[model samples]
Target chain A: MSLLKVENLQAKIEDNQILKGLNLEVNPGEVHAIMGPNGSGKSTLASVIAGREDYEINGGRILFEGEDITDLEVHERAQKGIFLAFQYPVEIPGVSNANFMKSSVNAIREARGEEPLSAKDFLARMREKSALVEIDKSFMSRAVNEGFSGGEKKRNEIFQLAMLEPKLALLDETDSGLDIDALKIVSQGVNTLRNENNAFVLITHYQRLLNYIVPDFVHVLADGKIVKSGGKELALELEEKGYDWVKDHAIEEQTA
Target chain B: MTDFNEDKLIEEVTTSDYKYGFTTDIEQEFAPKGLNEDIVRFISAKKEEPEFMLEWRLKAYRHWLTMKDPMWAKVDFPKIDYQDVYYYAAPKKKPQLDSLDEVDPELLKTFEKLGISIDEQKRLTGVAVDIVVDSVSVKTTFQKQLKEMGVIFCPMSEAVKEHPELVKQYLGSVVPTTDNFYAALNSAVFSDGSFCYIPKGVRCPMELSTYFRMNAALTGQFERTLIIADEGSYVSYLEGCTAPMRDENQLHAAVVEIVAHKDAEVKYSTVQNWYPGDKNGKGGVYNFVTKRGLCEGENSKISWTQVETGSSITWKYPSCVLKGDNSIGEFYSVAVTNNFQQADTGSKMTHIGKNTRSRIISKGISAGRSENSYRGLVNITKNAKNARNFSECDSLLIGDKCGAHTFPYIEIGNSSSVVEHEATTSKVSEDILFYCSQRGMDEAQAMELIINGYAKEVLNKLPMEFAVEAQKLLAISLEGSVG
Candidate 1:
């Protein structure tokens, strides 16, 4: 069964139709890269999949684990093993990173009818995950993303993703402002966490992040629709030819 | 995602009922429903106070009549009719008991329902609690243990009778009878409160706490608390209160005064959970309180920490007077106003001695259609050379209709004195809520986490037991406040 499937999903924010008749499917153990130009509904697709409330679902449906979940709340989707690494992570002052992760982990545990982790075990897990992302021990005690640089925020998001251990993780422009070193660190964290039982959807405008964590499938999104799909080499082609080449070909095919 | 209706969520949040709203059905007595010279005399006689005390009450009552209710607070309410309210009410049955077993079963049940089992508190925690209900002190636990350490801890009425000299000496020393409108009223009609005095060079062995409750209808509660720490002594005190829900607004005016002598340190903490009005602001307690402390000798210290999450309209300012050179004064507060509640509370630090230092940290949270404000004053006199003061007031608004305000007044008289003030106002933005929700926290859980984090600085100042209870109160007070 597919881990996530969206069939002719139409979504909009207010009067602006951001996702019109978009369709995609992701089976378990497969990484999907969503490469699109600006305003091509890349981020909106990721947000809608994560159950963001701002967008209105006008038609169609979303299924997760072969179960319809179009009406689930954002937290409900999260508790059911869906994670979104925010494009611009919000800063929550006075809440420590460790505390935030603890709450998240416990909420998921409760949703699964499992006992909460003890303080000692939670700390041990936090230490292990922080090590995976190269996040300093000091960051665990500091407020969540509160005085962090762009790179640090991205790293923190990846650290959270590792801690959550969701079945399907969506990275929305997670590589936008990261330096080469930071990007490598973030990708390394994702690579360490990936397994056959879980999958990732990497949303990026450039193919630079794809070089580190190679995707099995690269899909081009244009004007709220997936225009093309191919192997990982498609990313390389788009990188060399620029997004305009794909857009021109898609328009020509539509007219023909 | 399932869409949340903002209107429905707000209605649900605002109508969250008070948990401790049940009234106690015990036989009670009332001083005829009115306030006058006769009522003052009646309350004084009921407590069996001395002549000096009666004279003081009469003086305060006379002064209160001359003064009008101050209307400068940022709150709206109907004018209080002093003539229609009961000035005093207490349980008709009074028993002199040395143990909790001898207390009235009905009163015991009331306390148990409030989650404060005296027996459990006695066995698990070494806190000495002086329980007062309806302006009357019912029982005081651990009196023998406290007395052995040269600590005089008892009810104010008991102190007036047993330790008359001490009471007469320092009763109104810090907060005078003419301090304010409420303070004067409290002095004139106050019935029962906690009284503590730590002897010179003796450190209190355990925390002293007082639990107050209002059980009668149409009654105004006025209590007086006085604490004096002698030279080189230290003491920490805790206070908590609640009231039954009612349709007719009740008045609560309290006066608390503290005095710290040379090298003594006093820590006072309060978790006030009075019954707030209903969703439409129909009925609740009007809390008007006067609390002040005096650092009388060199190197003395006084700190006030309060978590205020109750009352429909609150007008309070816990202040400290730095009269001793090298003295220190600290104030930490977390005031939450939800539904139709309005709170205008903060602290005042007055520097009078050389090298005195003071710090103020106030956090105000407003939800529903409430208003929360932090109004503080920091003053350094000319003699306070090299004095320093730092004040930070932050306000958090949960919804668009609610309001948060900060008014900081600073007066520096010496060039050497340094004073700094910082203020910020922020909303519980939808983005922040979405971030938490996406991390698997529901609306209530997310609000609790954010609020606890925002007020951590103030909450940390409370003692262990009070800190836990305060956190729970904060959570309950803001439940369903956000969509």
Candidate 2:
């Protein structure tokens, strides 16, 4: 069964059309890397799926676990195990990361009709998750993403993803602006959290991330639609050449 | 919080009904509907005060007559008719109860509705409670336990009679009878409040607290609180207050003074939840308070923590005078205003001796169409060498129509003094709220988390017994402002 199926999704921000008939499908145990150009609607897809209110969905039917989630709110989608790791994590001063994660974890537990964890158990789980991404113990007590370095912010995002344990994790440029060392830690964290019953969506602009976390399928998003799909080697080809080749060939193929 | 039905929550929060609005039915006594020498004499004579006390009240009333009401506060209200307000009103119990157990059941229920039943406290932890209704202290609890430690805790009136010298020495030493318009008014007609004195080198066994309830109509609440920590002693005091809802705004002017001797520490915290008017801004309490502390002798310390959530218009500045060498002063506050409420509160720190230090952390949250401001002053005299000061003031606005302002006055006469100040204004961002909501917490939980985080620094300063209540108060204060 498919974990996520977004069919003919049409969305926009104000007057401009951002997601024009974008369609995709991912089954359990699959890692799909959606590589796209700068203006391509890669982040918009993740945002709309996460139920951000900025964009208006003109036409679409998003089905998660065979249930229609087209009109579900953000938190409702979250309770259903859909996670969107933001590109730029919001900084909430005075709210320590430990407390933030505790609230989030307890909230999800309550939604699942599970008992709330005690403080000791919650701290233990938080420490375990922090160690997943090589996060220092001190960072957990500091304000959430407050005064953190760029690499630290990305690592923290992955740490949250590991803790949440979402069924379908959507990564919105999660690997952007990180050096080799930080990239390895983030990818290792993701790999550790991977399982057969869950799926991953890696949205990125480079094939560098694909080497660490190999994707089963590679799709090129351009002009608000997936123009081509192929094996993981397609990412290497696009890296060797530029994305202009994909756009030109797709246009010629469409005309023909 | 997990049961997430936003429409239902919004509907519930939007009803601007005051929870403690029901008036208590009890006999009452009044001095008169006016302010004059005769009225002051009546109040003091009724309480059977010492001769010097009457002289002090008369002096205060005479001073009050010469001075006009100060117009400097950033609040707009109708002119108050001093002659029209009942200067004094007290519950007339036929046979006044002798103890907390024997106190009037109706009175106990009235306080229980406000979450301050003395019986409950006696059953649980031994929190010494002084219940002040209208113009008199009804019952004081745990007096015997506190007395064993050489710590004196009782009503101000009782203190004046039992410990006359202590009261006479420290009563107006911190806040003089001629301090300000409200302070003078309070000194003239102040009826009942808690008074405490921890003996030298003795730590107060338990937290000392006072709960003030106003149930009389056409009356004003004037309370005076005095606390003194002798050498090497430590004490933590908590205060809470409420009033019945009425169509016409009532006057509340209170004066609180604290003195810490050498090597002593005094911690005073207040949770002021007076009735804030309805959403239409019809009626509430005008809470004008003057609270100050004096650090006398070397190495003394004073800390003030307050959570101000109610009152139609609040003009309060809890200040400290660092007169002792190596003395320390700190102030932590969280003032929240919603639905036509206005609050202009902060602290003043004066460094008079060498090596004195002060720290201020203020958090202001404004919702609906309210206005919240932080006005503070930090002064270092020439002799106050090596004085160090640090202040951080932050404001959070929930709605677009609400407002927040900061006014910091810093004076440095000592070239060796080091002072640092920081101020920031932030709105409760929808993005942040969405971030929390998307994590499965509902809007109310998200809002509460954000607000608690914003107010954590100040709330952390409060006594542990009151921190939970203060957190809940912050959430309740911002109920209808956000979705």
Candidate 3:
């Protein structure tokens, strides 16, 4: 059975419809990549799944581990093993990265009827996980994402994902502003955290990210709908043919 | 539907009481309800002050009669009728008691509602606290521990009797009673406040704090606080204040003075959340305070941090006077005004010694139709050839109807001195709100985050416990003032 599913998802922002009757599914232990143009509503799907309030779910249903979670709050969804790595992470001034991650981890732990980690235990775990992403110890003391470089911000997101250890991770344009060296480090960190019981939904506009972390499936979204679904080789094919080819093909199919 | 129903509705609206409107019924002593030489003498006699201190109070009262009320502030309020309110109110005199058993249970209940029950604070935080209810210092905890460190912490009335020589030498030396209108008034009829003295070469072991509340009706509170850090000593003092809401506005005129000797340091923090008036501006406190510190000896330092979010009309200027060579001074303040409240509050830095330095940071948040202003002055004396000062004042406006203004005065008499001042005013932007909303935070939470971020520079200077309370107070004070 599929671990995550979205059936007939229709979303609107204000008066305009952003996602019209979209459908997708991902099985456990599988990585699915969604590629689309700038206005094809890829980011909107990520936001809606994370329980952001701006977009209204006019009609649809979202199932996480076979349980409907359409009306949950952002933090509630996070507590239920869902995490979203923002495309542009927020800069929370005066709140240290380590402090924020600890609070978030403890929040989820408390919700699951578990005791909170002592300061000593929490610090030891943070030291080990931060080293996995090549983050310096001083970075944890600084405010979250404030005055951080673009690549550093993305790395911090993955660091949080590692700490939370979520079941369903959504990566939204995580490779948008990274250099080659930083991209490799981030990809390695993602791969290290992947396991058979969890799944990932990677949203990107380019196929270069797929070169480092291969996806099990690739879907092409056009005009708020998935126009084509294929295996991993489809990502390279679309990279060569470009988005216009998919657009024209969809129009042709509609007319026929 | 009948005429009797209309009468019931009017009665229900007129009888609503304030949340913190409970009063203690133990006060028995009070001076007359006017300002004169006789009233000054009466207060001094009631406290049983020494001869020298009584002479000092008399001189201050004589000078105050000739001085006029200051009108330089932008605040507008009715003239204060000094004769219409009682000047002093204290608990009935009791025999000197050794333990908490002798304390009145009703007074303890009042402190519990103020969130600083003596027994509770002692058990939970391990910090010694002195409760100053209405106009008297009721109880002080942990006296023996402070005595072991050679520190003197007690009520001013007790200090006058126990350490008369020290009181006589430093009482009016730093801030002369003739400094200003409010300070002089406080000097003449001040009832009681905390007095702390740290001896030479010793660091205070615990945080010294005082919680002041105004509970009596139609009474003006004139509290006088004095702290002296002797040579090579260090101390951190925290003060928190609140008042019961009243339909008739009450007056609060307070004077706080501090002196730091050679190689000494003093850190003073205040979270002032006195009752501000209702939405229609019916009633609140009129806070007029004069607080100043003097860095008297070389290598001494003084710092002041305040989070002010109350009072219908507030006029305060907590300043620092750097007198000794190489002394330093700093001020960090965050003041918020909502509804019909108006505040004209900031600091002053006077550089009188060569190589002296000072820093001033002010953050003001204005909402509703309120008016907030940052009025500061940085003065460098002619003899101070190498003085330095840096100042930044920023304002955040939440609603379109409010107003914020900055008035900074910089005077450098010495050509070798360097001074820099910057001021900016900006309204909360729509784009920031949209970004936060897209991240799943509601509008109220987003506003709280942005406001906290804007005031981070000043709020970070407060003690950790007070910082959290100030953040919550900032959110609650601006409720409904924002859309």
Q: Which candidate is the best by lDDT?
A: 1
* Between candidates 1 and 2, the DockQ winner: 1
What value does the lDDT take at residue B272 in candidate 1?
97
lDDT of 1 by residue, B1-483 (tens): 543445544566576778888887888899999889999999999999889999999999999999999999898899998999999898988856676767888999999888999899889998988999898888888999888888999999999999999999999999999988999999999989989999999999899999989899888999999999999999999999888888889899999999999999999999999999887888999999999999999999999999999999999999999999999999999999989999999999999999999999999998899999889999999999999999999999877788898888899998999999888999777788788888988877787888898999999899999999999899888885422
Q: Candidate 1: list runs displaced more than 4 Å.
A: B2-9, B481-483
Error of 2 at B219 (Å): 2.7
How far off is residue A198 in model 1, in Å? 0.7
The better-scoring model by DockQ among 2 and 3 is 2
How far off is residue A170 in model 2, in Å? 0.7
Write the number of the candidate with greater TM-score, choosing between 2 and 3. Answer: 2
Against the true structure, what is every candidate's RMSD?
A: 1.5, 2.8, 6.1
lDDT of 3 by residue, A78-151 (tens): 77888888898877655677766666677678767889889999999899889878999999888878999999
* Candidate closest to the true structure, highest DockQ: 1
Pairs with steric clashes in candidate 2: none
- Model 1 residue B393 CA deviation (Å) reads 0.9
lDDT of model 3 at position B58? 88
Superior by TM-score: candidate 1 or candidate 2? 1
Q: Which ten residues in a row have the lowest lDDT in candidate 1 chain B?
A: B1-10
Candidate 3 has which clashing residue pairs, if any? none
Q: In model 1, what lDDT does residue B197 have?
A: 98
Model 2 Cα lDDT, one tens digit per residue, B18-111:
7678788878998878988889999998888999889988888888888888787677889999999998988788335466656677887787
